[model samples]
Target: MLFRVNWRVKVPSLYWTLMSFSTSHGAWKWADRLRIRRTTVDDYEGVVSVRSDINRGCDYIPGTYRQLLKHNTGYAGFIDHELVSFMFAAEIDNGCSVVIQSGRIKEEYEGRGIISAMKKHSFHDLSRTATRSVSVTSSPFACDILLQRNARLLCKMERLIFATSRHALKNTQRSPKVDQSSTIPADDAFLKNIFLSSEITSTIFPENRLVIRGTPYELVTSNIERILCLSDQILVSKDYGTGSANLISFGSTWRSNHTDVVFINLFGESVDDKIIFEHVHRHVAGKTSSCEDKIIMYIVCTKQQHEETVKRVLKKHSWELLVVHDLYAIEESYSWMN
Candidate 1:
């Protein structure tokens, strides 16, 4: 089993205390005007507008609204004909699990229990399908809500992005040559061992189980494909011009805001922060002579694996800590029942 490390930090008292607060009265006042419904293509423009208005510079476009509306399922909160909050999730692993994508509520409409309401309705709807569980990469605020709902925290994820510019990095930075031939082994015993022996996995209730398939290589490939599909959506959602091909060095792109910004999940004994940033810089510089946009790459890691060395490397490169996310999984297929 991986060592049980108490990596959970003590957040501010107010932050913890507020999790249990009932939805604000204002939210109830607006409930009459708020309508919760499945999102459609027609709602895409409104969703983008709301996301941009709330996110500001940090808020990049969510490029997958069209796909989400067509292939996946999600709910949007529209109050007085204005799309205020949007939540979406995609079924993966052959309907064994559902992963939540992007979601947000307008600042003025926050703390009104809108999210709580949205989750209640959304999960209930998803449970009717074949989905056995649900997972989400949650921001601190979302983490609090999951905790309040007694959701299990699988791992804490830290998102760090490197702004790729030719001048942002020193030429000395270089990544080790990746062995293209040494593919992930055809067997998946490694993954089974990792998942079963994990202390975190042991804590999950027996009745609730996560079903998985394919060898580690197969699994990794599928995951990468999904990430690429999502990245394609981002590319279409906004015009950031063309980005470099090697923007994703190791795995697939995890999340993307604009052409310049992207994220990926990387795992290996030797993976380090310097190589990641360096790779992006090389690609972006190799593509354009003097690109100004900050090329951003994000990675998610558990608190335990997020070591001091990695943190130090990111800080040295002036990487931004975007989200202190806690990942969670609902144990049963019908999570709403619990």
Candidate 2:
């Protein structure tokens, strides 16, 4: 475990003593009312209740919550017997890394230091694991929380193109034809070439080494399958159909937590805005089974040109920009400062 080292003493004792004064004064309302405990199957209903009432969609599915509870590691904070917050961490890379699933607090409990307390409680458990890294994909605000504890930005999730409008599909089909190309089944070689391509290299983690350790081949293949299984087809383009040589783009569709996600996982070779939109429109329109309410499309881009192109083409397609964050911390001492 990472915290097995001598650094345990260095982890500040403020958390334990923060309420000492309140306890001595007999005004320790939180001391007795607020309690953090392991989440159990019996608590599922409460968790879901909190979720159903939340203003935003959950970060994970219901089944995931059950699985985390089974591990006896998922946590919940309750006050007056009302579940107010929850969190779970799932190990990855054979326990060398852990991806924090999600941390949530009910709306009424916000700004009460509930999230901070939950982090301290959960990090204690994670610190006892063989984890070497911790990763989280969250919104900008959530990223800020992770950042306070010494995690750094690995990458910003961007460059997504999506649309579900039947009109958009028709418009795309009739839209000015950029050269169109045939789809190629994604293979290891094809994906590797794209990964090593100068365009992708320049656009991904330009300031960092972009070391996505553990099962690159598996990650890519699984992503491809995620699209194929959720959507009817994968979109691949070569030379942007521009009659040019040595250009490639890859795309797929998937669903997450009841949201329809169209992932343009790979793109470049040529930055044809029309081609990008056309592919996304076709994928979304072709898919008969998407989420009941919304179809969320995403892409990862880091270049000014690609970002601009995506914004321009997707504006008319009911697309909205959402920040995707990749935050990480060391396994043992989750805080880099350690």
Candidate 3:
């Protein structure tokens, strides 16, 4: 699904104390002054303002903020009637889990317990139905805080970012001989079987979790359809030598800050380097519009070797490596009577 672009727009340790603040006078004073509530369309400007203050390059919130607000999943925090923090508990895996996304607090409000308070409110609202909470972060401090909360570390992946223009990518020469037949478009039946296959569940996915566009979904029958719906193109690559599925990849496209963005999630430990490039090529080509348009591509790989392979391929294609991030996936499960 393609989303249109609407251009706009954590310190852990002491955080625990702030989150667990009791009914003491001091805590009450702080709690009474801050207001927490579900976000509405009215909060759009405030959300954009808070995001702008952080100065994070190329944010997707401005474009998808409204879409994310659907299902009443967005939440915000306010002090003196100013929106300081915001978060979204996006439902995934057939509503059996929610992956927290776009959580942010103004730079001035960092470590002031604003985010913790917002999380407390949001999770409380989702507690009855959402049995699992999942999040992906590149910040070591955030990872530490999740670990402190007893969230299991599912797996870490290398986030590879590349910046290139449509012209550069289009002009790049293709590999002399790529086994195009090895990769094929994945249909409903193919995805249902591959995603649930025991071999794929144990080996391709990290810890039985399928991380797509930075959100993790457990590899299960219920999640197969959602996964297929979320991705624009799902490709399965086979090893001709062995005639076995060797890699499965998901690609998605959206507009952010006037530039086209393509996100590719690759699952497999043993994949051909050429095939990896081919998958990326197909996604970018499908979205490329003008020669002058800029494109940013984010690729997530579970294996270090795959990361290296992607780097080599991008370099060969004249794509500039922007920055690589060490991303971690954390999850915590809850038990509740149905």
Candidate 4:
């Protein structure tokens, strides 16, 4: 097993609580309109007008006249005759978090605590819906409102344009160089290993699962960083061998003697992991490092072929490689981060 360390995912923007505000009553009354509480569907056009820019980017568009109306099972707040703020909350399997997604106030309504009022109302509504968390990506203005409202830090993932000290210590900040001729043909074995590993849920993952097919000789220092920063594993097919896994994970459940080992990352429906793993161990065993980080070259394949990769990886050199089972967990680790 190549597992070693584990790290947590941090959601950058979110609010823990909001200052109390009076609830809305009796329709969109201007005098008390600011206190009005209702689903966004009521003020569809108004909300869209207020958040024109934000709505444009939403899957259902920020203010798309409740095109995301179903998303409003919880709360949508309106100030008077116009919708000023709204939130969407959904509780699915793996994990759940409600996202304020979008909120806006009119030019004239900017400073009156209208957005705050809506946020306060939305929070309460989402809470009632059993929503444990929420996330918002864009809208600098909204980010502030959320912060002021007191969103707790779920996680803060920054784009480290440059390698961090930890990364440097691990020696994983570099781009990989794959010689064209050295590119391993996507064969039945390669394909099988990627898909059947149970690590992948589907072929074309919701998140991009990168699998770089190249020779080790071609992999550059930068390539190491890219792999460390991006992929779940590195696969070096025995027949097309060239690189070594040079770093360990922030956290790993797998163990490897090769300080610099190469693991594979593929998404296919073929099997024969034994060959792949033996290849990886053979190539990596040559490196001299004790950092124990598994920095490797990644290769993505299909659902079926993934099995072959694992088979080769696990059975290789008489079961020498510890096959890390779940790719989803791996993919999600660095893949989702900025």
Candidate 5:
């Protein structure tokens, strides 16, 4: 069983005495509350903000992000009344993604070492379960947390694409109804279009149903290491379809959390160029399924095969059609300060 290194030290009496004076000493309040409880949907927004503040690279999905967490083991650390510090870890025993999501300490509360205190609580919660493992992305702070906690770094990818597809419910002048609800299953027909049928995907061209509104395809793969990357994910047609490959390299283990299955690379093989990728994107967008939440798919690929990579991804999740994209290129320029 994995556990935290015992790096305990006596808290200086002066610090505790100083903390006693301030009401915002809410960190301890959170630590106290967590002792007898677990986190829930109610604490999402606060934690989301912390996640956003700490990682400023991407957008967030609050509605469905925490939905699946309820089914598995979840942990939260509330500071200053709201959940200022949070960790969303998934269990190895479960089929869900064991993500050690956003962690943050509020601006005013930074110097207090609140993150470590909150992590202590999180690790304690995780230790109760018999699950063998969990997953977390790479972050300097998170790296420290894992190291201090004594968790193994089983595996990691440099650039993981945490992508999801959302039905752009028009929030304009008129109140139009969303034909589909707010969330969809990861294995629905829509996702299947982008994940289940790649072999026959080349048969279809640009005629498949596709959605092209949000993030542009070129921007998605501009930095991805691929041959000819395009911006797209799911695609569908009369008979065959594709997986989230518009901008993805079919399957590159960037943000792949699937514990049981791994995808094959469709780079430089029996793949078709031309409209194959576009066709799959079209089918993925126009397809309908029972899922209601926003749907999105992530792909990683060889830089040389970016453009036609979608043709390979479509063979899998051809049913669960949704938005598709590749991981953002890791900019070495920005890391110099770190």
Candidate 6:
């Protein structure tokens, strides 16, 4: 009903793309309308509705929607005053790069070119200052589309999800003992030193970037504070012989459908360090089980060699492997600015 425009019109920084629609005379018509603009708190309900519709009411979007808006720049598309699509972009690496995420389109409105239009609008808005854009996705369609847009694949990771009750975790295996000296306190100064150390950066992080809670951030001083704020708990294991960090993990928890979801990003020197990996994994699980009853845990392994390590550890703790999928980090560098 919002597509009754009889005359072509244009607005500043916004344009209409005429799509062919069949008419009685088989003539071309422009019946598709998409109005994209910067999203605000007022659009929260609409955003949640579209997200729930797309994900069938099972997702973290509703819980993290406000946080996303508060932390990133968001845009929404509407047709007939009804929100149908949305996306978010966070400026990271001191504005040198932007991470695009939380993109969703209503189920009924798929394949309407809305995603393409939204990408163009969002990128144009960000390209003024950002030199590159990064995104992570598990969808094959999205991968193909990004490749078509000249986006390079930065890295591939395996997303392993373990679902188990706290009771089950406690009953299965004895807690692994961790050396108290190896536990790094969650202090700003201490974390910054470890995160920025050359040893950890070269060996643990993928492409020199830390992907925490599904968002990739460059490991630099400017981002340390921000990263610290985003994580709920950070666990690190130090190699006492060299006094350098060998394993680092971040844990963040959110409630979804009355269940507590714990997401962990684990980085280790190599698969050979399975002992430390298992120790840190047990430590995190022990901490979470103290407060949460129903838990869904997510672990991401960037190195292919470490996938088996992750699975073996989860299995050792009697955790159920609900799903495993490949996650790709893609980047598109802007040549116009360079």
Q: Write the per-residue lDDT of candidate 4 for residues 2-121, one digit (tens) a residue.
A: 431122221111111121122345222332466545554565555445543321122123313354455334344555445555444332212233334334444444444454445445
lDDT for predicted candidate 6 compared with the true structure: 0.65
Quick one: best lDDT, which candidate? 3
Candidate 2 residue lDDT tens string, 1-338:
01111212321111211211122333444534678887777877777655543212423335345644544267788898888777664444434444444456665555456655565556666656533344433234444544554555555534343434444444545556554545444455554554455655453324322222111111232233322332244455555345322323344544445655555543344467666665655655654433435555655554456666777777765565543323222223445312
Against the reference, the lDDT scores of all candidates come to 0.44, 0.47, 0.70, 0.33, 0.32, 0.65
The per-residue C-alpha lDDT of model 6 at residue 285 equals 56
lDDT of 3 by residue, 117-215 (tens): 665566667656777777776655557766776778988887777888876766764446476898899898886786667876676675777887657
Residue 41 lDDT (model 1): 81
Residues 1-338 of candidate 5 have per-residue lDDT tens digits of 11212214212211211221233545554445432236677766654565332212222324334644653345555543565544444332222212233344445444454544544444445645422323333233343444444544432222212223233311111222222221122223443344235543333212121112111111121112211122223222221243323322232111112111112222222244333343333323332233233433333333334423453444332323222323211111111111
**Which of the two, 3 or 5, has more TM-score?**
3
State the TM-score for model 2: 0.56
Give candidate 5 regions above 4 Å deviation: 1-37, 49-58, 80-82, 94-99, 111-113, 126-133, 138-153, 156-298, 301-338
lDDT of 1 by residue, 143-162 (tens): 56656666655434444444
Name the lDDT value of residue 231 in candidate 4: 34
| Candidate with maximal TM-score | 3
Question: Model 3: residues >4 Å from true position, as ranges?
Answer: 1-32, 40-42, 53-56, 70-72, 93-96, 173-177, 333-338
Worst 10 residues of 2 by lDDT: 11-20
State TM-scores per candidate. 0.60, 0.56, 0.82, 0.33, 0.39, 0.80
Predictions ranked by TM-score, top down?
3, 6, 1, 2, 5, 4
Ranking of predictions according to lDDT: 3, 6, 2, 1, 4, 5
- Report the poorest 10 consecutive residues by lDDT, candidate 4: 329-338
In model 1, where do residues sit more than 4 Å from their true spots? 1-22, 53-60, 67-71, 93-96, 130-145, 166-228, 231-259, 271-292, 303-338
Which residue window of length 10 is worst by lDDT in model 6? 12-21
